[model samples]
Target: MTDPERELNFAREIIGQRGFRDVPTDEVLGEAERLLNGWMAGDFRMERPKLYDHYALLLLALLQKNRDLEARIEALEARDA
Candidate 1:
């Protein structure tokens, strides 16, 4: 598979293994920052920079979605209580 596809598949595997509902927002943001920093530092020697950028963006989007779901859950719980 291509680099972007590989990266996305790896991310999916990690999220699936850990269960996305159990993953904290900070952890997701940290992963995104790590990816961005690695890209900035030229850590991926063979992959193009844009690939990492896309990966970072994907993580950020996931983070936002996670936060939104957390908020909704909290609201539902509070309403039920």
Candidate 2:
């Protein structure tokens, strides 16, 4: 099956099993429609690449430098104790 079909099937399975009657299905569907319309209209022409780049940078900075910061803080605390 195509990716869209697969995604829809997955969503349907989850929604069906969870019995999301209390949740606003209309609102969720409307948001999906709006997002698809925006993509079809090319609203993400520049923003998509920027979002990918920014997300990658954020992941790298957080995963790499954050660990270094934690180690440095631990060393400082040990020295003072």
Best by lDDT: 1
lDDT scores for all predictions? 0.57, 0.45
Question: Model 1, range 1-81, lDDT digits (tens) per residue?
Answer: 225424333244335577665766667666655655654675523245445434654566676878899999999999999
lDDT of 2 by residue, 1-81 (tens): 223322222223223455444435453354445544544675422244444433432344345556778999999999999
Among these predictions, the greatest TM-score belongs to 1
Name the TM-score of candidate 1: 0.40
Model 2: colliding residue pairs? none
Off by over 4 Å in 2: 1-50
| Per-residue error (Å), model 1, residue 6 | 18
Residue 23 CA error for candidate 1 (Å)?
24
- Superposition error at 48 for model 2 (Å): 1.1
